[model samples]
Target: MNIISENKSKKIEIEENKSKILDIKKEIEEKKIKIEDKKKELSKVKDMAKGEKEKMEEYKELKKQFKKIENEIYSTIAPLKREMRKLEKIVTDKKLKKQIQEYIEFPVKTFLNDSDLNVFRESIPNIEKIEKNPRKREKILRLIEYVLDGNLEDKKKEYMAYKEKVDSFVITSREENKEGIIKRKIDNLQSEIIKSEEKIKNLETKNDLLQKEILKSEEDIIEILEKDLDVKVQE
Candidate 1:
């Protein structure tokens, strides 16, 4: 009787549900407000994230150039893999076979690390013994001899040239990015953005269910009051 507003009750059957306050109607409204506020916060965070990424333009460009130079180095050393694969199968020496395998696996790194083609020089005699597929063996041996003769030394020099670019890019990137402070900030913001977006999606999903449940609750209350009490209910 105290909750009655004329003929209407001001309070419902329950003030809360479960361990947490679950005022259904109020919860839906509060979540709607939070969704909007979060959207605005996300927009600002996105803008800040954009600004942080812009600051790393130099580093990004360096990365682009680094990939380009790496591809060039890869292209330069690519043929060695095919030559080594055939020769590795034909060569009998265990040590030389492994050395050939290294070049096949990390062609560019192995080539650059060889130093004046000493790896090829050491393996030359072993490779010379390869005579299984006479034609194929001749071809593979030709490649090893080419490296020993310093004809392929230019490729190593070429790799070193790209290495210089990488070294310079690293030094400049560290100095400009200032130990990656901007990159770290950008990464953190990206992580926050993902979390915030997920939170908004979850809240929206909950709000949708809450809104429907509230409507259904209202319908059930009206039906019960009208059928059981034999009275019209209006609020």
Candidate 2:
């Protein structure tokens, strides 16, 4: 071949090599762009995954807190519920039962404190004792006076007069047995018993109403705990 032909061939070869290099550079630039775009997409996916994980963790913690609240409510209320049940069994009167039901349905937190719980505990047993024994009826009457926010000074004077009259008649009758006088005395005793029974009924009614008021106030407290704090209390 001639020198011109050889030079021309060499130039053609160099041009071909340059074109291949350009193509390689273009492919590398495209791959770099694709890699950058993939990195961006991966970062977004990672961020979304992290957000989802955080939300799940937060939800789990919230559920755990709610469970704890439920447990606390149950623990706080269970003993009071048991005591209420015992009191219910002891009191057979319909009015007393209704009052006890109100107490049972009252809020868990009402009697949680030591002072309140002590009062409730003592009150139940005292009520039961007073109801069972005639001698303790006076104590119950006093409690009712306090509950009703009333002064019973006049009623107490009347009771004292009746008691004195009965005692005087008893002492006189032991010394002289007059049939007519004894009959009249028996009638008076019967009348006094009836009045005493009526007074007891009225006192019991007032006591029931006062207890209901107390239970309702406690019920409001329980409602706040249940609705706001997510505490579950057994009714």
Candidate 3:
């Protein structure tokens, strides 16, 4: 009876060990599947990072291309725009009939050549801001008109004043030139007078010497006459 009982116990112990081994195998299989799933997720993340890097590179290339295009546009168009603005001014100025006629020969060129387009574009924001507020727009327009009128009037006055100043300067310059010539003539005349005075002094000194020589000759003649008269009396 004791031997049979020990055999039965060994069989139950062996079954229990087999069951624990099967459980361990199942657990290891589940852990392996989880590890594989984590590897797949890591692969997807790596692919996503690569895709993002490619997208950024593409974006940088596109930005460089766009900047290059913008630079080309500016370089090509700036001078053309400046010409257009000058033509526009010529057309607006009433005195430029010849210029207007010349510009009419190339209307398309004139229109495209206006560099003021950039300035107009920049003003759009200010225009929109003003338009959004009616009171502000009216006030701004009124102020602009007032300033323009004031400036126009002031410009006329300033031009007249400038003309006067220029005329005055011209007159003053002419007067100064005349004064300079007159002074030069007076200096020449004064020099001539000094030369004449020097000549007169020279002549006076020569006349005094001549008069002294003549007086000495006359005295010598009188002494000779006296000696001759004395000799005649002794004879």
Each model's total of backbone clashes: 0, 0, 4
lDDT of 2 by residue, 1-235 (tens): 5444544555565555555555545555555565556556556555655665565465556555544554554454444454456566766678656655665776333323222233343454456543656656555545443423423333334434544555554565466544444355545545554554555556455555545554554564455545544533432
Which stretches of model 3 miss by more than 4 angstroms?
Answer: 1-146, 149-159, 168-180
Q: What stretches of model 2 exceed 4 Å from their correct place? A: 77-235
Q: lDDT of model 3 at residue 167?
A: 55
By TM-score, who's the top model here?
Answer: 1
* C-alpha lDDT score of every prediction, in listed order: 0.59, 0.50, 0.47
lDDT of 1 at 219: 67
Off by over 4 Å in 1: 1-77, 80-97, 116-119, 122-131, 174-235
Per-candidate RMSD, Å: 12.7, 44.3, 60.7
Best by lDDT: 1
TM-score of 1: 0.37
Alpha-carbon shift of residue 187 in model 3 (angstroms): 2.6
Residue 36, model 2: lDDT of 56
lDDT of 1 by residue, 1-235 (tens): 2213312431142212221235434554665566566566656666766765664565576566656755765665565576567567776779778777888888767776776554566545655454456787676667667657776566556656656766776676566555356456556655665665666567567656655655565665566555545543432
Ranking by lDDT: 1, 2, 3
